[model samples]
Target: MMTVVHHRTVDVGGQAVFYREAGDATAPAVVLLHGAPASSFMFRGLIPLLADRYHVVAPDLLGFGYSAMPPVERFDYTFGALTDAVEGFLDTIGIRRCALYVQDYGAPVGWRLALRDATRITAVVSQNGNAYTEGFVDSFWKPLWDYAEDMTEEKAAPLRGALSLEGIRWQYTHGVPDTSLVSPDTWMHDHMLVSRPGSMDVQLKLFSEYPTNVALYPQVQEYFRTTQVPLLAVWGRNDEIFGPDGARAFRRDLPDAEVHLLDGGHFLLESELPAVTALMRDFLGRALPV
Candidate 1:
């Protein structure tokens, strides 16, 4: 468990960004970036494992988590802007080189930083991160994509309902093998994130901005091929959202990339932390260790 050590704020582009850090500062850094509707709390369980040997840091994205959201007008909330924010974060903390564990929305954030600072990345451990053309499962994302394409107040807003606590519980267990593990508090917390004032609007707009990333997928693949950074993909075999096809696709761009499709769904990290953490530790030890 992560013992609260007073939430510290960092200045990123004039925004007071909040984050949680653990372990020895002198150790090689291992930063974890979370996805939509989630805060750094997503990695709370895994932090202690990595913290024992590596400096671990996890941040709530600008508009998500406990971090400050300076109105949509002040910030674009697009991937380009987020990538720049993360770059500034690295520079502010003076992390010359670090290994990144990316999940969900973190896929784009980490990839954006990877493309810009490929030389600075020593290793990457991705849990359900996007890569290759196959990873883009059209059918699974069709509903959300359609909503983003044609958002309106009257249209069937499954995506909108899906962001709520009740909806999130279903999402976390739609095709999951272990429904028993879907704790009430988990859904409640995740729901609380998207339910905050302006949070729903933030998510809706971010959904609209997702197409920009879809358009830039090709560039992301090229970066993986060109950078040749040590990469590993740990995906939940039963992920209804991202699907298994996406996991196989990582090999097309990264032939040497290692992949592990474990038993779980979208939020696989929550179910398979021990396995994921072990894989990350082994990979980081060889590729980016102190």
Candidate 2:
């Protein structure tokens, strides 16, 4: 494992955004946006492979990893807020354009960026990120929507508690064919992020807002179709949460997108990094005109 060589912070809309960067500074920029629960650590294995060829930037989203976590009263963890935070982060970094590798919760932030600043996106590589109703399994998420519908301080505590270490481990390894692959450090890191003061609240609030994305997926797909940018869907065939169907459906909106399905779970890149990294390199070569 390569040690973290650089760390920095930039204020984005009054919130301090923390990010770690590795690899060549002069190479083409590639931003790795991680999903919920996991931080930039999701790309631990893949970063080294691309760092030699690309300047890789990975940040712990608002409430994840080393980033700031204001209370729910102070920071709304809605999809809009998440998008705006990333937009501000990009502006602060002076990244006019970048190849975006988005995963899970990253879909909302990346989609928002693609729509809000279409010209700034060079290429899009998505892993298990969806932009259509068929991509979602409502049954898996119905309880969350129901909780949000009747949210209250008294009832929300249980939801917050559910993000604990044990809860996180369960969610992370849930439905995986081989649970032994999930490392202790992975669960430890994710649990640490959620268990932070008020961070759990932010996560739960974000969970509640998931329904909004379900309703807004059509808009995201339309934005992609309109932008006509290069898109790739690298899916984990074994993902229990978000199925392969989501990856297939992405092609409906992005007819030109390149799709690859691999044998892994929601966290495929962790288990299968080399193959994914090669796919990313190939995708970038095809998507970005030199």
Candidate 3:
């Protein structure tokens, strides 16, 4: 029988955390953590593909998606807080150990989870999720990093377009060779979410705290070397942000880690949905062939 995405909400210490679950609970799970300006919605198309063999759960971080979007002023938007929220969700849902699939902003949150409790991680699949300092290349992140240092209205003003209709549209379409493959509804939905009152503030707070994740790279790399968790890193070579170098870095720490770079952009799943599905399904089978 085919499994459909199941919409469910669980209260994680009074916070209503929303997630999409599929497949059998008894099977090994694949926890999908989405990136910024997006939620579990990004994983909608990818979930059912793997649901047959693996339990899949994708949650929106505290400030993103349909999850409770508390005001930035009221809630802590740091990566640490985000990880805590995710850990709580895992606990509440009775998911003790699972494979982690991290993409974009999901990188920091998921990596922190793995580092905090390495034993809970069955394996890791990194898709355009970067951890190395070198991964933050000059092309995509330099301007954002500059804005982070100053954080003045003037400095941040230049980046406001990223939250706009066209900007969010560009985020999904830009690096892909065939722009037609990108869906307009993807950005249109995202624009509506960020357009909500106070969402921008939450984004800005998280953007400024990105350096914290960078600082954690040392610890993350150390965890990789010591724990030697099975890893499968599939990157989009065309991604301007979190470029291919980040994918290759896994080999430095875990030489046996399987890595593949595909011809897609930051939101590679958008453009290479079938290809990514095939790669992930195959990788998971090999990486966790028990």
Predictions in order: lDDT:
0.79, 0.80, 0.88
Q: Per-residue lDDT of 1-290 in model 1, one digit per residue for the tens?
A: 55433356799889767788887878898888887777787887788788878888887788888777767766788878877887888789778888898888888888888878687777888877776556666765777778776887644377787786777886677666778866666678888877878877778778878877778788888888887778888888887677778887888878888889999877776778788888888888888756
- Which candidate order results from sorting by TM-score in descending order? 3, 1, 2
Worst 10 residues of 2 by lDDT: 134-143
lDDT of candidate 2 at residue 59, scale 0 to 100: 77
Work out the TM-score per prediction: 0.93, 0.91, 0.97
Over the stretch 166-265, how does candidate 3's per-residue lDDT look in tens digits? 8788778877989888888799888899889998999888888998898899999999999988988988888877888989989999999989998888
Candidate 2 runs further than 4 Å off = 1-4, 152-162
> Any idea how many clashes model 1 has?
1
- TM-score for candidate 3, residues paired by index: 0.97
How does candidate 1 score on lDDT? 0.79
For model 3 the local lDDT of residue 32 reads: 98
The superposed Cα distance between candidate 1 and the true structure at residue 33, in angstroms, equals 0.8
- The model with the greatest lDDT is 3
Task: List the lowest-lDDT window of 10 residues for candidate 3.
Answer: 134-143
Tens-digit lDDT track of model 2 for 1-290: 56454778889888888887887676678888999788888877777777766788987788888888888997778888888888889888877789999998998888888878788889889898877766666655556766888877765666665577886676667655667777778878888767777777688788888877778777787877887778888988877668889999877877888889987878877666777888888888777633
User: How many steric overlaps are in each model, in order?
Assistant: 1, 0, 0
Winner on lDDT between 1 and 2 is: 2
